[model samples]
Target: MGLRTRPIGFGYFKTKFNDKVLQDEQDVGTCELLQDSKVRIIISQEPEKSNLLRLEEAPLIKRIELLFHMEHSSIPMSLEVDVSDTIGKLKERIQSIESIPVNRLVLSFLGNELNNRSTIHECGLHHQTHIEVSIRASPPAAASTASGSNAGSKKLKLLVLPRCGTKKIPVEVNASDNVGELRKQLPILQEKLRFSLPSNGYFFIHKQSVMDDKRSFRWHHVNQGDTIEIFNGWVTRGS
Candidate 1:
C-alpha cells in the first residue's frame, strides 16, 4: 500500500505565507476605525454640552415682594408677585383676597399712579417696595347707576382662539357676562361660522389661568381685544 503525503490546499498555503501582512493591515484598519468612532462621539457631545451651557447662562426669573398700605389701616399687607405681573393683575389679586372692587381700587407707588397696563418692573417697583392703596370716592347714586349701566351695556370684542382651529373667532360680548353664558353661545356661534367648533365640554383660558364659569370677564381680567383660548376638556385641580 502506497502512503500519500497529506495534501496542503492553496488557500492554507496563501494564508500562512501572508499572515504577517494581513495582521498588519487589520491592525491599521482597526486603529483608523477606532479614531473615526472617537471623533464622531466627540462631535455629537459638543452640541449637548453647548445646550447645557446656554441653560446655565439663562437669567433667573425674579419675584418681587410688595408691601401694600391701606389708608384706613395701620398694618401693612404683603403680597408676592412676579416682576412681569401687570398693575391690573396685582389689583385683581388684592380684589380677590381683600374683597375690594377692582374698578375702585387705586395703586400708587412713589406718589405716582400706576397704570393698569404697566408692568411691576416698569413701575420701578423692587422687592419690599411700598405701595399705597386707596379707594375712589363714590359718585352720586343716579350718576353712578347710569355709568354702571352704560359700562355694562358696552360690547367687548373678544378674540377667541380655539385649540383645534386656525381661524380666530371674534365675538361681541359684555364684560359682565360669565364664562358659563359664553359657553352657551358656542353652539350659536358655530352655526354662523364656516368651520366647526368643539362640541364637547370646553373651558376658557385667560392670562394662562383657567377662567371660572361663574366669574365674569372683568373678574378674570379679560379685557377688550384680549385673546381667550378654548380648551376641549375640564381641568381637575388637586389631583
Candidate 2:
C-alpha cells in the first residue's frame, strides 16, 4: 500500500478554473447575442394536402377582335368586343351594326381620342386593334340658304342650357322641328327636367352655333325666347 498517493487539489484546480471561465463567458455571450439581435429563423410551411395538388384554375374572360377603320370605307369593321366593353359600349355596337351615329362615332386608337368612359381593356384594345373611324362633320349648308322659314306647326319656346345639373330648361319646341326631332322630346324632357337625358346623344348650342341635328329650329336661327345650349359628346373639329 506504499504506492497509493492521493493529491489533486489547488482549491480543486481553482474551482475548475472558475467553472471554465464561466462557461467561456456564457459561450461568448451567446455568440454575441446571435450576432447583434435581428435573428429571424422562421421555416414553417406545411399546407398542401393535395386535392389534385391544390387545384385552383378558373379565370379566362378576354375576347378582343376590333378592326373598325372606315373613314371612307373599303370595309374594315370586324368588332368581336368584350375586353370589358365600354368605349361607350363600343359606340352602342357601332350604332347597331353601322347605321352609324352613336353621336357621329369618332373612335380612334393609336392616334388617341378614345375616351367614352374608356375600357375595351382600358384602350389597350388587343387582337386585331386598328380602330380609327371618325365621322362628326355634317352641319353646314350655309344655314340652308336662310329665308327665315318657320311653320311646321309652330311651337318653339326653348331656353334649355344644360351641360350638367339644372341651370335652365323651359323647352317647348316645334317650329318645323327636326333638331333630330328633339330626340322625341327626351322622355318628356326627362320627366319635366328631373334630369338624366344624354344616353350618348345630345347637341344644340345655338347662337354660339352647333345645332343642325338635321336643321329646323327655324334652321337654327332659333327665335321664340332663344338660348338653346345642351352638349354632351359628339362635337369634334381640328384639321
Query: Could you tell me every candidate's TM-score relative to the true structure?
Result: 0.37, 0.25
| Overall lDDT per candidate, in order of appearance | 0.74, 0.67
Off by over 4 Å in 1: 1-58, 141-239
State, as a TM-score between 0 and 1, how close model 1 is to the true structure: 0.37
| Model 1, total clashes | 0
lDDT of 1 by residue, 108-220 (tens): 98798899999998888998999999998765884777677677755688888876548888888888888788778777887788655667667788878999999888888
Give the residue spans of candidate 2 off by over 4 A. Answer: 1-58, 61-88, 92-103, 111-135, 139-155, 158-173, 176-239
Inter-residue clash pairs, candidate 2: 119-122
lDDT of 2 by residue, 1-239 (tens): 11111123321111112123122224445434444444222222332233223233535568968888888788897978789878988888888877877877888888988989988887778999788888886555534434335335577787776764567777787788788877677678778668666678767788888876777888677889887778787876577
* lDDT (Cα) of model 2: 0.67
